[model samples]
Target: MKRTVFIIWLLACVCTVRMDNFTYSYKDAMRCKEHICRHGYSYETFYRVDANEMRSINVDPHSVFEMHIAIQAASNGHIVLSEIPNPGVSDPVYEIVVGGGGNKFTELRRNLRRNAKSSVTTPQILSPIELRGFYIKISEDGLVEFGREGQALPLISFNDVDPLSVKYFSFAAWNGVEAKFLYDCPIPGDTSIEDIPNSHPEEPKLTPTDKLKRTLLMGRLPSVPPNPVMEVKLGFKLTSFRYNTLDSKLTTTAAVVVSWEDDSMAWNPDKFNGTTNIKLRQGQIWKPSFYVLNSDGYGAMDSTNPDTISLASSGEATLHFQTQTQNYCFDTTTTYSRWPHDVYQCLIVIEPWEAHENIKIEILDETDAKFEMFSDIDTVIHNEWQIMTEQVTLDSAMWNEIIDLINSEEVLNTHLSDKMIITVDLAKNPDLYNLVFYVPMLVVLYVTVLFGLMTAVMANVLLISNFGEALGKSSAMKQVLTCGVVRAVFCLPSMKKAANGDYSVQEDEDSSYIVDSREGVEEMERSDKEIKYGDKAELAVVVDKILFVVYLIVFVGMLAAHY
Candidate 1:
C-alpha cells in the first residue's frame, strides 16, 4: 500500500530534468550530431564558460564526491582524462590518464602554483583486456582515492591535495579508444556500502535508422535513399520597434523562437511527387526572413546589408534592423485623433530551398508575440498586439545534381515564402511634430521676409531715382557730379549718316547737320563739335554707377551662398 501510494504521488508530481554532469559517451556524440543535423547547433552550448555555470556541483570542504569513469579500448587509439580549472582560477590543475602507454595508467600534472602541493594517485595494475573502469573518490579535505568500483581499498590515494579547486573534468578519446562516464554521485562520508544503489540508469541508445537520419540531416551523406521528410515548428516575438525621424527610418527588433516536434517524421518523394530546387546554408535553416509592406513599396529586406539584422543561435535569436518609414501604410493628413485605428502590417516567413523531398514547416499561433514602437525617449508610439499566423509548406524533388549549391548567387534573393506566411498588424501613431521648434522657425521666417521687402524698396528708390537730386546738398553727390563730368567727353555718341532710325548720333569732329534716322528728320548741330549735356547726363551716370555696385555685391553674395 505504501509503495502504491508513493508511485501515485510521483506520477502526480511534475518533474524537471536538468543535466548537471558531462557524462559523454559514443551515444552522446550521436545525439549531438542528430541535433546538429535536424536543428541549429552552437558549439558554445557544450563548452562555453557560462554554459556549465548552473551545472557546477558544489563541493563542501569535507564531503565525499565520487566520479566514475570507464574506458573501452579502441582498435587504434587511447583515452585521456583532463581536469579544467574554474574559468578564473589557475591553481591546482592536473590530469589522470589511462590506455596510452603499454596499457598502464599515467598521471600528468602541470601549471601548479609555486607552493601548492598535491597527493593525486593512479591505479598500478591493469588487466590485459582492452576495457578498464575506475571510481575516484574526493574527500572534503582534498584527499583523492582512486581504484576500481566495489574494491575494499583504493589502489592509490592522494592525501591533502585541494581537489575542491578543480572546476570540472572533461574526457576525450583519440584514435580508436572510447571514453565513457558511467556515473557521478556524492556519497556521505558516514554512509555504509549497502546504502548505495547497485546500478545507475544509462542513456537510451540510438538505432541504425536514427543514425542514418542524423547523418542525412547533417548533410554528412552525399545522398539518401528514397523518401525524405523534414518538419519544423517555429514562432517569433517582436521585442521592440520605433521610428527614427533623423534618419527617416523605422527600426525593428524581434526575437525569433523555433522548436521541433519530438516525433520522428519523414517524407517519401514517390508519394507526393513534385520538384522544387533550393539552395541554402545549414546556418540559414532556422533564420526568419522579414518582408515589410509600407507606403514606399513592397520588397524583401536587405539581409546582406551589414545593418540588415541577422542573429541566430541554437534555437532562437534576436534580430534588429532599420527600414524606411515609407515602407508602412502612412497618412499625412491623419492627426492624433484618428491614429487609434491606423494599422501597418509586416510579413515574416521561414523556409529553406530545394529539398529533394517534401518538407512541411509550420509557424504556430500561440506565440503571443507583440511589436511595440517607442520614441527616441522611450515613449510608446505604436504597438502591434495582433499577429496573423500562416503556415506554408513547399516540397518537390527538383534536387540539383550539384550538392554544394550554396555557392550559387541566386540564393541571396531566395525567400521562405512565395506568398505571405505570417502577418503582424502594427498600429501606427500619428506623426509627432515639435511645435516648440517649428513655431519659432516660422515666426523668424515671416520677420525675415518683411525685413527683406523693406530693404529692397529702400534700395530701389536710392539706386533708381536721381541720387544727386535727392541728396543734392550731400558732399558725396558733388563728388559724383565731378566724376561724371570727367568721363563726359568719351560719353559723346558716335555719328552715323541717315538710316531712317529714330535716334541720331553726331560725330564731335564733323559738327555737320545730322538727321534722325527713323523719320529722315535732320537736326542742326551746335557750333561746338564736342557737345556735352552737363547736369542731366552726369545724374544718369551717377545712378548707373550706384546700381552696378549694388548689383555686383548682390550677385557675388548669391553665388557664394549657392556653392
Candidate 2:
C-alpha cells in the first residue's frame, strides 16, 4: 500500500516536459453566429511521472479555432492552467490553479498573483482515472468563469479591468502526478463524436444493463427494511495513515467500500451475454455520504476519487468510497501522558449523513483483522509506533440516543440515526528513546551518587589527612587495589584492624599525601606549624555521606517513574 506523504510546496521554478502519449478524436464543433465553436475534441494523454508536464491549445483568433474548451482531468497534482493573451511574453497572464503545491484550494490569479480562492471540490486528484469533465468560458469583456459541466455557479471567476483577448490556453501538472486531460467534447447534436472509441451509441434497443437500471429506478433511493432492517455492509481497505504529534490529529486514508442489494437492478447472466456488472458515478444513483463525527476542526471526509460505482447484475451496488480524512484523536491526555512508552486509543466514528427509518449500518466481522494485517506490512516508519489493534463495531443504539439528545434543544442539525465506530489502538515504540536519552541519564545519576559515597567513606584517608595516613599507602589497600586473591586472603583481618582504630600502614609501604618523606623532610617541619583546609574541609566531606543517601533516593524515584 502507498503511504501518505506530508504536504509539500511546489516552487515556481519547477520544470516541465511535454507528454509524448496523445490520442485524439474528431474535431467537435457546433455552428455558432460568426464561427464554429468546438464542443468535443477528446484527447487522452499520459503525463510523465514526477516531471511537471505542460500541454496547450493555441486558439488564434485570426484562424478558425475553438474559442471555448472543456477539460475533464483526473490527477492529484498541482494544476496551473493559464491563458496568455500575448503568448511569447510571459507577463500579465490569467491563471487558474487547482490543488496548487499539494494544498487543497482552487485559485484565480492575474499576472500570477492570487485574487481569490475556494476549497477544491475533488479529492485524490492524484491518479488519472474515471475522468470527469468541466468547462472554461472567456467572456467578451475580459471576464472568465470556470465550473463543472452542469454547475450553476462557477467555482472559479476572475474579472480584469485591463484584459487581453484569450490566445494561448495551457495547463500544467506538477509534483510527480500522471494526469489525463479530456477535452473538445461534442455538443448535443454532434454526430462525428460517435466515431470515438467506446462512445455510447444511440442504440435503438435497450440492452440488459439498461433494462436492469430502468427496473431499479436507478436515480431513486431503495425502500426501507421490509418489517426487517435492511443491512448494509461497510468495510475499510486502509491504504495508509499519518499522525501529527503537535496537533494530536490522525489522518486515515482508506477505500471504504459500501455494498447493498437492490433486487430490481439484477438480471440473469444467460439473458445478457454473461454481463455481470455495470458501472455508475456518484450522483447517477442514490449514494450515501459518510461523515467524520470527530472532525478536530478540519472535519472533512472527502472521496479521494469521485468516480467508479460498480453495480453487479444481482442488484448489488458497491461503491469504493476513497476517503481521506483528518480527525481529532480523543482521550489523548489519558493515552499520551507517559511520553515514549505511551499507548493511545483513537475512535474514528463514521456515521451515515442521510437518515432513514429502514436502512441499518453494519460492520464487517473481518474488518479489524484485515486492518491489523495491513498495518503490519504498510510502508510506514517501522520503529515509530504500532497499530496494536483495529476494531469496527456497529453503534445503532448509541447514535440513536445521541441524535435524540442533539434534537432535544431547538437547533438545526443533521445527524446519523446509526453509526459505525472504528477503534484504532496505537502504542509508541520506546526502544530508540530509551537508548538515546533514558539510559545515559540513568548512568550519570548513578555515577554521581557513587562518587559521593566514596568521598564520604574515605574522606580522611583520600582527601584531608585526618585518619592518620592515606589509604593508598596502606599494605592492605595496596593488596586490595593490585591483586584480588591477596585482598581476599587479608580482607577479614584488615576489617578487624580498621574496627580497632588501626588504619595503619606497613613500614615498607608507609606514605603520606601531605608531604613526601625523603624530599620534604624540612617541609614536614613547616607543615607542623601550618594547616591548609582543616575543620571546614572535614565538615564538608562529612556532609557527603548525607547527600549520598539523598541522591540515591532521588535516583530510585526517577527509575520508578520511568518504568
Candidate 3:
C-alpha cells in the first residue's frame, strides 16, 4: 500500500519539458525540400572541435536559428561560434565556446575566458552508443540556448545584451571524440524523426498524471506562441537586493507571478469527472520566454526563469519564478558622491524573447506590478540596503529589437512592443561607512589642516619642508581610494606640492599610488634661484586656507546632487 501511494505522489509533481524549435515554423509556409533520397546520407557532416578541420556556418542577428547536435562521448564535444568573421579561407578566429563539454558536463566560454567556476552538469544525458537529439537556439538579444531531449530549461545558454552578430561557426571534437552534425532544414526524403538525431524530437503523447506531466500536451505544441498577439500578465516582487562595492554590481533577487489565458485549454466540463483544473510539469507545455535585458549572463537562460503552470478549465494559466540577477548599476557615478547615504536605483528589464507581433507583456499594477511586498522593507531585504518603497516602480518599455523597428507611423504603432521595466530603489546604511572609513578620514583631514594653520601662522620654512617630505602622512590617506575604489584616490598630499599648486596624486595602472608634483622629485629642479623659497612659504599659507574652503564646497555639492 505504501509503494502504491508513493508512486501516486510522484505522478503529481510537475516536470518542465519544452518542445524543440521546429514548431515555431509556420505550418502553411513550411515547405519541404523536393527530390531528395532519404538514404543518400551524403549531406551528413562528421567533425570535431578537438580535430584540426571543421565546418563553418553564418548566423542571422534578426532571426532565430536551430541546430541539431549529436555526440556519443559522454563528456566531450565542441560547438564554437565566432562573432568576428574570418579574413578569406579561414573562419573568425575569435570564438565563444557554447558547448565544450558534451551532455554530462558543459561550459560556455567568452573567447579564452571561462564564464563561471562551476560547469553545467547533467550526468549521462547522452547515450554512449546512439545519437541523441539536442536543439541549439540562437535568437535575437544575443541569446543562445541548447535543449536536450529530456530537460526543463535550456541546458547550455549564453546571452550578451549588446550581442555580437554571429558571423562564423565551427564544430570540433577533442582527439578521441567525433561528433555527427545534420545542419540543413528539411530532412531528406521520407526520414523518420527518430533516425535524424539532429532534427526536432517528436513530442510524446501521454495520459495526465501529477508527477511527469498533463493531458493538455496531448494534441497541442506549447512551444509555439499564439498568432497575432498573446497577452501575458506579470506580477513582480523584489525579494532581495545587495550591492558589491568592489564589482559595482547589484545582485537582485525577485519573484515574478505571471498569468495568461490559452484558448486551447478551454475544455467542456462534461468530458469526465468535471475536469475543471489541471496542474502540469513545466517542460511538457508551452511557457513564456522570460529574459532580463540587463542580465550579467544569458538572459532567459539563467536559473531565475520559471516553468510550473497552473491551468484552470476556464483557460487561465499561472506560473511563478524565484529569480536572482547580477545587474550593472545604471547610476554608478552617484555612488561616489553619496557614499553611505547613497540611494541606488538599478533598472531590471524583463521581456519575452518573441517579437512584438507574437507576444505582449501586460504589467498588472496591483500585486504591486506585484512589487508591493517591498513596502515592508524590514522583512523583504536583510542586507545593509534600505528598500525605498515609494520609489520602487514598474512600467512598460520597448525591447531593443522593437525600438529599432519603430518609425514614423503613429497609428499603426498602437498595441506594439512587449517589455516591462522594474526599478528597485535601495539606500546605503550610513551607520557603517560613517563609523568605519568616513570618521577616521575626517579626523586625519582636520588634524592635517590644523598643522597647516599653525605652520602658516609661524611662517616656519623648515616645518613646511618636513611636511612635503613626509610620506607617512599622505600614504594612509591615499589608501582611502583602495585600488578600484575606481582609478584615482582623491587625497591630500604634502604641503610642498600644495604650495606649488601641484596637488595631483595619481594611482598607477596597477593600482599602486604615487605622490608626485608637476615636477619629478628625483629630477626636481632645486636651485634656490628657481625655487623662490620665501614666495612658496607665503603661498603655502594661502593654499591651506583655500583647501579648507574647497573641502567644504565639495562636500556640500555632493549632498545637493545626491539627495
Per-prediction tally of clashes: 19, 10, 23
lDDT (Cα, tens digit) per residue for candidate 2, span 1-563: 12323222122212210111111223332221111112222111211111011112322232222222333234332223333222233465556655454535566666443544334543332224333334565554655665554445776776666654443444455444444444334332335533221111122346777776565564565433322445677776555667777777887777666777767566887777677888875666655566787866444467766656788877777776567777877555655577777766677777766555435676654345433433443333444667754646545666656657878764433443466777776677667787888778868877877877776666544445634345445565444433434334323212222233434222233535534677655664465445322233433433454566677798788778667
Where model 2 places Cα greater than 4 Å from the true spot, the runs are 1-230, 237-239, 244-248, 297-300, 331-337, 343-345, 356-358, 366-383, 388-416, 438-563
Model 3 earns a TM-score of 0.37
**Tens-digit lDDT string for candidate 1 (127-218):** 33322445665666767666554455665566754454433444443333433333332232323433232221223244444343343346
TM per candidate comes to 0.26, 0.44, 0.37
**Order of candidates by TM-score, top first?**
2, 3, 1
Which one wins on TM-score?
2
TM-score of 2: 0.44
lDDT (C-alpha, whole model) for all candidates: 0.39, 0.51, 0.51
For lDDT, candidate 1 versus 3, the one ahead is: 3
